[model samples]
Target: MKTKATLLAFLLAAPLWCIAASSYPEQVFQPEIVIYFGDKIGLTDEQREFIVSEVTTAKDSAREDKYRLNVEMAKLRRLLDKTITGEEEAEKQIKRLFEVENALKMANLKLLIRVKNQLSVEQRKQLRELMKDFNPKKIGPSEEVEKRLQAKIEKLKKGMREMVEIGVNPENISKVTAKFQPLINAAKYKEAEEVLDQAIKMLDDPF
Candidate 1:
């Protein structure tokens, strides 16, 4: 009974674990990556068509598997909710859920393998190089934000130096400017902008 309960708990938590795991993009070659860099990688028209067809088929299969998974999860919930559920029946449902999840993962793996096999050696090498520089966080705001933040910091630093040269207290400027890099690194643009504005205001009204 203890073992069955433990198994049940693990199975119940499995979906949440999968969801979290899926948040990170797989490092392996995927169809979307090929399509996105098709020109750069010199993908042939035939190769592009093949990849698109495979992706379409895989997406269809995944949709069906996801539907089946949701239905099985609902059934498991119903079984556990009953006042006199049998341990054996719950175990059976959990096993079915596990199988569906495994099938979904397998289908995705097959799709990725197919995509990888279709690419030429040189294209694959180029893709590998591209992937090396692929930081997911660099997807948005990009270099523009970094440039703007750097410019702001430089301006703040120059202002602080000038104020210090003139015998103004540097404590408040130091405290606020110290926060600029961290906020920028964390991509907290709004907070960083506010802090920048505050620094600018301080520099303007250093009294």
Candidate 2:
């Protein structure tokens, strides 16, 4: 009886764990502009089709680069912790980490450039706006709404540089925790609305 109960509990928990792991925490490709353009801008079925495919390709490429770099950084951090002894080794680790970070930024920027080239000026604006909305890994509210947040992003870059001069990262867990929680809790919850424009294109299966 005890063994059977333990097995049943494991089976029940396994599905929940899988669901949690598989679900996108902040974003799934629920493109809002896709629906809007289909309905309001009257995108032909073909244009809709091409845009959906292009957008997915760009997003996936960006995500892959981000994940790959994060994994690399984690491995490097463990190696540094285990073996690095002096300031020189630490400096080398930091340099390699920064290079990897810059590469990832360049890759994402190139993908964004491709996205911009593929989209019309107006559509590109809408796409950015849509990305700001649906992209749940958001740093904070929209730049339009958060001048302080925007300024702080720049400030953080400057601060990071200064910290590097003094051999620090300036990444304070307590400070970061204090910075975002108020915004997170006070912000209104918005539901993800379907993108009809993408859906019309999705009739043919772009992903």
Candidate 3:
């Protein structure tokens, strides 16, 4: 249960997937702000329940807004990819995309403000540490290792070229991208590629 809780803490800190693919370094959802504390931040059962209630309420409230915003990113991509669309329409979609993205962020911020006020000073510190640890690599690497890591990252970044060559979904490349981010930061290419291989298999499999 502790292990499960630990996993939830990390995954919940990550962006919530609703309908469309998010841009890289995806925006975190409102519910996840408090859910991040349910396991790793040492909350009492009562406190955890309260946080859960708050998140559930916020998620339900934001559902429609999130879904609408989710479609915009994909819409923008499709519009840009198609040559038939004029610059005027593309400009409008770009403007709407920014507005929708901001609205989604504001919705998250409103809930975060409420959650922030409820936390004690110690809990705030714990949240800070949690965030600090969430960053994959805080330590500096050797010069030689850094170069090799950069090369691997650049290669991984172009999944359209690399992933498709191996018969994986270029569209779902975000799955592999998300899976390897932490490993890439640690310069674990061998392990990272193993993860990539597993992701490729899953992506390639016909349902």
Model number with the top TM-score: 1
Cα deviation of 203, candidate 1, in Å: 56
lDDT of each: 0.74, 0.45, 0.56
Every model's TM-score = 0.55, 0.36, 0.40
Predicted structure 3: clash tally: 0
Candidates 1 and 2, the one with greater lDDT: 1
Candidate 1 local lDDT, residue 155: 87
- Show pairs that collide, candidate 1: none
**Candidate 3 residues 1-207, lDDT tens each?**
344344335433553442331232223322343344435666565665565566667778678776776677567666655746577986897678667666666666666666666667777766666664453333344567667656655655564566577776566556655867555433345556676655545444522
lDDT of 3 at 187: 35
**Segments in model 2 whose C-alpha atoms lie over 4 Å from true places:** 1-38, 59-64, 121-207
- Ranking of all predicted structures according to TM-score, beginning with the best and ending with the worst: 1, 3, 2
Candidate 1 weakest lDDT stretch, 10 residues:
16-25
Give me the runs in candidate 1 sitting further than 4 Å from their true place: 1-27, 136-207
For model 2, how does the per-residue alpha-carbon lDDT over 91-125 read when each residue is reduced to its tens digit? 67656655656665555455335434555566555
lDDT tens digits, residue span 7-34, model 1: 4577666663254323445445766666
Residue 135 of candidate 2: its Cα lDDT?
Answer: 38
